[model samples]
Target: MLRAMRYLDYAATTPVLPEVTDAMVAVLTGDFGNPSSVHAYGRAAREIVEDARDRVASAVGASPAEIVFTAGGTEADNLAIKGATRKLRGNGNHVITTAFEHHAVLDTVEWLGHDEFETTVLPVGPDGLVDPAAVAAAVRPSTILVSIMAVNNEIGTAQPLAEIARAVKGANPSTLVHTDAVQMLGNLPVNVHELGLDFAAFSAHKFGGPKGVGFLFARSHAPVEALLHGGGHEGGLRSGTLNVPGLAGLGVAAEIAAKEVDHKIERVGGLRTRLWQGIEDSIERVRLNGHPTERVPGTLNVSFEGADGETLLLLFDAAGIACSAGSACQSGAIDPSHVLLAIGVPREIAKGSVRFSLGRESTDEDVDAVLEVLPGIVESARRVG
Candidate 1:
């Protein structure tokens, strides 16, 4: 029997590839040991954790000593933002970031602000890109950290990280620059050194690995305090017992992703362009969000005027086409995406936006299926409502 539908929500999460699953399963069934114990079994598990760290670090142009694993992207972001901000509290209390950042970063900064730190959320341009000059202007003498995302989850806009890092460092070399690279890790080329960032966050599931594992890359010189207090683990920055199976899966996924990134980019970019072209040719009253050329290769966000995003999503779901209204983390909420609002999209249009994110498993047939079904769904939604 033929499958009824297709999934295009790679931005939310990806299914674990067979190889990644096998790697994790081996650890789960064969060498199940608590990495914190002093026994030989624990040592075996700890070795797997360390090996995964090296793979993840090498994929991002960092050393194994710099990688710290966490539960996932949210924990990694919280630890990087809250830990760095609190550690630098003695030096300063102000922080700067973009308004278009994922809620993980935005909410974390807001919570930090409530805790007595000052925060400046810089506005993005119409293209959803932040100006380095604006970032520099927002930095106060008391600013201790600058947190920006490598890619906007809603619109797939890629930030000028290298430039922003340079601007922040030039303004105050002591002001650490951190980027949420969770969405960018598999879709784009990421080198922490080339970006000039002091710290960065990444999640394994975003790149075909297990869901429970992620890592933060903190430069050797960057000062950061631990978010969790427990048995000394992850160099005291994160203290929970390591997830051995998840770590093994992450290691295999990282190595595979690093080797295939260039080819994936080329293939996914072509698929995205094809999908966009079909939408442009068939759909009316549609608008594309984010910088057309500066966005991620496999993400296409568009708004259909006068259509409700949630309704369209349901219709698409019935048709077996899977996508998202915005960031999956924030999808259940009623409010429109803050990212679209930051880019100056009207509230009504923003409420109608849909994000189609491609992945390695997507194909021309999948794109064609969506192109065939989406226009009718939009038209039907417009007519009924």
Candidate 2:
């Protein structure tokens, strides 16, 4: 028999839950009408879409009307950053974000900066945390928006969104706050109102739902412009035929997550701790790459002093272990991780880092498998490097 693959890359994407799959199959077979068409069949399809909207909103503590479905987390980030800035540009041309963000946000802001916007890319501390006070200090009267990610996909560090939002608003009440929260939904409870956020982005696939469907939480009063214009679907923000089956899957996943996230967090946290402890006790010179206590429970980033990260990944793959050198988006790039470099990791150390992210289905056996195999893999990779 083939060896079972020990998967540890949930931060890249998660397997769709069985319930989500069943929900999607049901919609695929039964609700195949265009939701915008005015017929009984269309009405039934519209109900499925709207009910999913409500379920997604409830999971994130937002109103159903505020959730604008999009293609995925990248589109949600693009819409939130670009759409919001376009709408608010009349107020100011200045925008602020961090040094290390997903390219969806970083690239969007970079493109805007090339045009008419004055952009501020703030530096993160060595511990992978952004200081709220620095955000307040960066806020100018002409600053229109501030975008930050709730959790770093590479390091699993959770930013203090509430504090950052409060700081931004205190400095300029008109400056809007947005977060690329694609990594937050499955790891923590996200409440847009409680966090004082004007916008937030999420992807269903990151949390056990189907891929290619996600939503943007645009607060009721937030000013946002249409990125895709056509028949004016999604309140005219994103116009396209709805992915009914994907939305149905997303709804079920959200509902299940709302009930089980706490338990998942606890269980995954324990597994991550064991994995880290095992590596620490067994390996000679591995460094943990994020804030010890201020990160999500499911992720652990480590750097082995003398091994190349790419080589480590290859050996791990050959050994039937799945993991990543950094964000899946930057999978094959030659450079070290921007997040690690931003947090003051030495270039050599950064080049040797890898990430292990657990999920709801991860268990003690997975941890045991990693511990049993990792030391030899590291040794082999070090000699090869």
Candidate 3:
């Protein structure tokens, strides 16, 4: 009998929900119009875009006016970090971020440091947690922007955004706080006020919406310079015509996620626990990465000892299990996870890391499928590797 395919990579991206697809189809076909135009068709398209803006804003506890749509989370991160850094250069050149932030923020900050900006990347402990006190110490009079991720994309560790924000604010009230919250919007509780965030980035595709659609939440007081020089769209923070269909789908997806968040967390968390327990019972020397209790519900990055990471992934694939070795953004990277190394995992051990991210569609049978196949897959990998 052929093994059934089991997908467990929600952190990378999610399939669009039926409702979201329906909304997207309507906008793409019947409601298609230029949002910038003054005509009737344009007005209709513009309304859809604004409505999506509102939906995303409400989900994050921010005002609609604060939401600026971007092409995706990467663009949102670029806008938040680069835009803010450019605007605040005269005030200060120093910025602070975590060592394990996604490349979007990491590379952007590094690039900024190449010329006009000074940056400080803080370290995370074995638990993949950034200390709030460290952030406080890093804050300087010249610190202009502090960027951190709400959740680590590789291990799914939830950073203490609220505590980190408080630290940054306590150190310097003038410093702006930006968080890459692409992984938190649908998977965890996201409230800008509660987290005290000056800026945040969210990707719709991470939450069962269309790809290539995301937004940045900028506080009214925190103004970022434009990344693109064009018709001055998106409050001059970003330029170019809006993605009406993608935005419409994103709005619907956000609304659905908001309404179903509580149940999804509880259910997905239960599934994660079941998976962890199963793996612990079935395998020896398998270390769990990320925080013990502070992680989101759907993510589990495990390092399988005595098994080659690449070979193990192939074995799992042969068994019809779909997962990841690192962030989907680095789909074919051969290097060990930078996240694992940052958290103090040895290079040899990091090479065995594999991430299994559950999602809304996951069920008990999916978890069982992992339990059934993983042990044999590990044995096969160890034999060959």
TM-scores, one per candidate: 0.98, 0.98, 0.98
Write the number of the candidate with greater lDDT, choosing between 1 and 2. 2
- Candidate 3 achieves a global lDDT of 0.91
Residue-level error in angstroms, candidate 3, position 328 = 0.8
* CA deviation > 4 Å runs, candidate 3: 1-4
Clashing pairs in 3: none
Checking candidate 1 for backbone clashes, the offending pairs are none
lDDT of 2 by residue, 260-377 (tens): 8788888899999999999999999899998998888899999999899999898899888899998998996747999999999999988889999999999898999889989899
In each prediction, how many residue pairs overlap at the backbone (N, C-alpha, C within less than 3 A)?
0, 0, 0
RMSD of each: 1.4, 1.1, 1.6
- Which regions in candidate 2 have their CA more than 4 angstroms from the true location? 1-3
How accurate locally is residue 165 in candidate 2, as Cα lDDT from 0 to 100? Answer: 98
Candidate-wise lDDT, in order = 0.90, 0.93, 0.91
